[model samples]
Target: MSSETTAASMSTTTASQNPADPVLAGLKTQEAHPVSKKLRYADIGINLSDPVFRGNYHGKQSHEDDFTHVLRRALEAGCEKLMVTGSDLKQSTYAVQIAKDHPGLCYATVGVHPCSAKQFDSYRGGPSALLSAIGELAKRSKASGHTVAFGEIGLDYDRLFLTPKDQQLKYFEAQLDLAVEIQLPLFLHSRAASEDFERLVSARLPQLPKKGLVHSFTGSVEEMKRIVEMGLDVGVNGCSMKTEENIEVVRQIPLDRLQIETDGPWCEMRPSHASAKFLKDAPPLPKAVKKERFSPGFMVKGRNESATIPHVAYAIAKIKDISVEEVCEATWNNSIKMFGLGEVSK
Candidate 1:
């Protein structure tokens, strides 16, 4: 059969399962949600452009079409806006392209991740040259479409597996400077480099823009406090809620300063953590997702997707001693203000 014919067959087979089936029920709940009642959600950081997520990791699945399906599922789960992150020049360009294609629904950030910092020296002209190129791309994206933030940049000491500490710092500071120069909000990442990350962000606070979010924050309460004190927002995801200690740190996050993301196909919430407690009481995975094996982790049996964001909200509600609606409203509003999604809202 032709590729198109095969794809149609698979989609039909996945969709034809009985809705009463346990695995198919959750998808029905998500789909049956009222259109008017569909609360809007903004995923502040998700690598939708990542090849692994687009289905490259799996055999023969068309990731391009899968992104469309993912977006539809996300909408049903209340996520209408997504910020696609770019960890390097090529990825940044791809992110911008995706944002352009999706318009308001998808936005992008353009910057080099600290993990990729070593590549800076090898660029055509080197560090200064790459920075200049990034600046140009940021300008072009801002002028053309939905490029809301300037990052994916910061230090990651946990696995300097590729870039050295010194190089990561060098590139991180350069991107921070670029964010300030461009006057855009920042999407940052920092792991195991809290001391230096805190010091660096603190030093730059005076001139940096008011909107900055530390994505996937898996740090201590003290570190969370410091980040909040510096006027930066905290992004919480499956990664942030991985441990009971992390959950406690999550509890410390003021509602106004907290944002939720899936960081999907990566940070699937483990059952042992607090954030996933709702799953015990929640509906089953959608049958189509199971058939496709979209979720990650053997325990969860699926990779994390934006559609699972409601679980994150449920977890936050349990932790913060507030209603799920309250958590959702706050995070949605936080995302709007932080990412400037509200400016273009209809």
Candidate 2:
């Protein structure tokens, strides 16, 4: 099918007309909800390597793998480019392979997540070997244009129970040094550890030209301003828009410095979210069924996919009172500028 047709089909809702008199209610529905144009989107942070996409949930195989179908849906929805997030060495390897399988359409990032910091200390080959493996994979994949950034790395005090403060701190700094040596931009994370996250990232910002983004940002407006002032971009996902305060901070984010992500299948937008009100006029998404009842073309319910990225843009547009096209264009450019994902087809 043509791109235009694919875009139009993204919204499955159709106007039902009365055969006797087809002019009033049907026309009103059409007018109130017109078909949206094909606006391009780049999902800058998606965990495509997550086992959930492959039908594994909580260590159990619940259904058949539908990874390719998810990618197809994302492309049809105008999310033409996706950056598969790599939280650690194993997942980073998987992410790189996914990128290789779908060049241009997909990309990858490589680094250890702060929550999984203890993996560094427990690796069979030792901490330095694990770090070296990540570095080698990043360097190789980057040279081939498969890997664009060097993270999913940073501080996360909220999940210190998973990895203590000292370990998280030590490895976060170690990974930052690796990013500096590799000379790649960052894909950072921070949750209630802004002070140290900022201190460490800022200390190295002078040497990193591309800088980086704090993906899935949920900090206060003042915290956001500090990040922007430090020359870093802010990435927004459903988790970033859960409340009124989050929406306000997103509104304050500079369009040029803003990027969008799914961070899925983790940050799915829900009905109770503050951002949901803005989506009243947004295009309807494709039909979804529970994961157990999954089919080839239907989205797995409760499992976030890149195809819903437009909903994110729609919410931001409504919050900022701007056109969705504006949001798409500015964010597409910002992502390309930051990650060098190359030109995207309009």
Candidate 3:
């Protein structure tokens, strides 16, 4: 795959390193595969958290500024808008700042991530406290008209930094309860906890939104079918988009039920020599990523190539074997619908 930044450039080498350096992670799926079949949906979820690899901060350095930059790039790439996910209280507030600043261009999902849920005394206290935490977030989301759903809210069995599974479970269920009470769609995340994730989701299946998505989904067709049956639009992004397993899954997923994303400033999509065209649409924005001399969302410069959003879109278009406009329009549409953009989808 083609990437603007090399692998070495993405992982932090030292604590003294610049925090603004754009760290790239990488992939896409969900709205559909055939270019003509992509329904132009919007990306309902995006990671605005600053990555803390080996304890060094390196995701979205300053939420407002970075978000503004990413928002512009997303819009330029043809996304009508997005629903942002915050990392924690501070980050969530910063996300709200972004939402308040750009009412139509951005939306937000409020919840402490599974990884960060431990730090919150409220989350640590119990479901009631978690609800209170969510309540505070809910108020802000309402105030900004951007709390599209409850999200970045799920289990991360893999990253058990300090929080235990039971604690994560409590935190997760608590957030899920909030979604049920508020009657909002959910922006979910699950890493190495699929079976547990399924049990949790299944228990609450009846209470969730008619439509939502499992962000950065990686699962077998059966698992996908289960979630799809529950009415969630599977979010297929760049990282998973290039894989054969992911591709095969994409080939199986019904077109209209799918969606796409960059998960930008993270999940950086690498362009393949074979599938160069599928990597367009993610414009490389590196105000902070300059230290590594790399851009996350797009492939690095050189070989007479520019890693712009349109370029990623082009790459996606070619990979799906569909027209560029179709890919753009459908994913854009999908985003709007997923985020409950309603009349604001324009």
On lDDT, the candidate that comes out on top is 2
Across 33-147, the per-residue lDDT of candidate 1 in tens digits comes to 5521545568888887765455555556533335556665665667777888989987787778767756666789999999998889999997889999989999899877668
RMSD of each: 6.6, 9.2, 10.1
Residue-level lDDT tens digits of model 3 in 41-140: 3555555433321112344332212222343334433455556677566566555654554555557777777887776554467656656866677766
Residue 18 miss distance in model 2 (angstroms): 44
lDDT of 2 by residue, 1-346 (tens): 2334223322222122222332212322232223333588899999988888878788787887677668767766777689999998888987887777566678999999999999999999899999999999999999999999999999999998999999999999999999999999999999999999999999999999999999999999999999999999999999999999999999999999999999989899999999999998788887899987878778989999998998999999999999999999999999998898856423
C-alpha positional error of residue 101 in candidate 2 after TM-score superposition, expressed in Å:
0.4
Clashing pairs in 2: none
Better of 2 and 3 by lDDT: 2
Regions of model 1 farther than 4 Å from truth: 1-31, 34-38, 58-64, 280-285, 288-301, 342-346
Better of 1 and 3 by TM-score: 1
Question: For every model in order, what is the number of clashing pairs?
Answer: 4, 0, 63
* Cα lDDT for residue 167, candidate 1: 96
Task: Give the best candidate by TM-score.
Answer: 2
The order by descending lDDT is 2, 1, 3
- C-alpha positional error of residue 202 in candidate 3 after TM-score superposition, expressed in Å: 2.4
